[model samples]
Target: MYMRNRTLLPATPERNFQMTAKERREEIWRLIRSGLGSQDDQARATGFTVSRVCDYRRLWKFILREHPAIADGVTCEEALSLAKEQGVKTKR
Candidate 1:
């Protein structure tokens, strides 16, 4: 014969999720487009660390080099999509 279990645990509330790298990049781009120049402003707007914002800047430069059209009023989402389509890997 098997013994029955009796203990039950209470459910915990879920915490808010953090932004992913792609989302952070997109947010940073938006801030830049909206004229937020400083890294501090980007960090505040995107909730990313200063180093991560700097990383995004580096990635943006690389992306711009590979795709000049991205600098010509292309949306951040479109640029990211094009980068993926071209198999350009973002730094992890």
Candidate 2:
């Protein structure tokens, strides 16, 4: 006789729409802080291309270096906005 195990894995809900820039950046930051430093790993986790992950990583690195307060949440949305206001070139 053969028996099937009756365990089910939890599933995440599907997203039909793309994440906003803010949401994407936040997710990338979360994944980075989770300690998966490899761009490939981040891309797989975020369902983004490796190059896209690299772009977000570069943005975060720039923010951390040039504007730690923004990176650390002086305000939500300040990172990109402030960077633009400062005339820093950043790819969204």
Candidate 3:
């Protein structure tokens, strides 16, 4: 007699539509900090492409100007949450 298990691994949810560009940029910075090094090193460790790393850095600079608290070691999720709490909207 053969028995089949009904349990199956759940599929990963799609990430494309969930995070906005700002959120994505913040996430990249978080990855960089989590690695504790330069963009090149962070990219290597996080598996992000060099071009993506550059974009993240540029976006991070812009975000930092708008939100100084981000530089104070706030997590990307926290930053996004704070922005939401403040009713900030992303530019289209």
Best by lDDT: 1
Q: How far in Å is the alpha carbon of 90 misplaced in model 3?
A: 11
Could you estimate the TM-score for every candidate? 0.51, 0.60, 0.43
The best-first sequence of candidates by lDDT reads 1, 2, 3
RMSD values for the candidates in order, in angstroms, are 15.6, 8.2, 12.3
Lowest summed-lDDT stretch of 10 residues in model 1? 7-16
Top-TM-score structure, candidate number:
2
Q: What's model 3's TM-score? A: 0.43
Supply candidate 2's per-residue lDDT for 6. Answer: 33
Number of backbone-clashing residue pairs for each candidate, in the order shown? 0, 0, 0
Off by over 4 Å in 2: 1-22, 74-76
Q: What TM-score number comes out for model 2?
A: 0.60
The digit string of per-residue lDDT tens for model 3 on 1-92 reads: 11123322112224524666665556566755443456655444334567777655554554577778656677656655655676654322
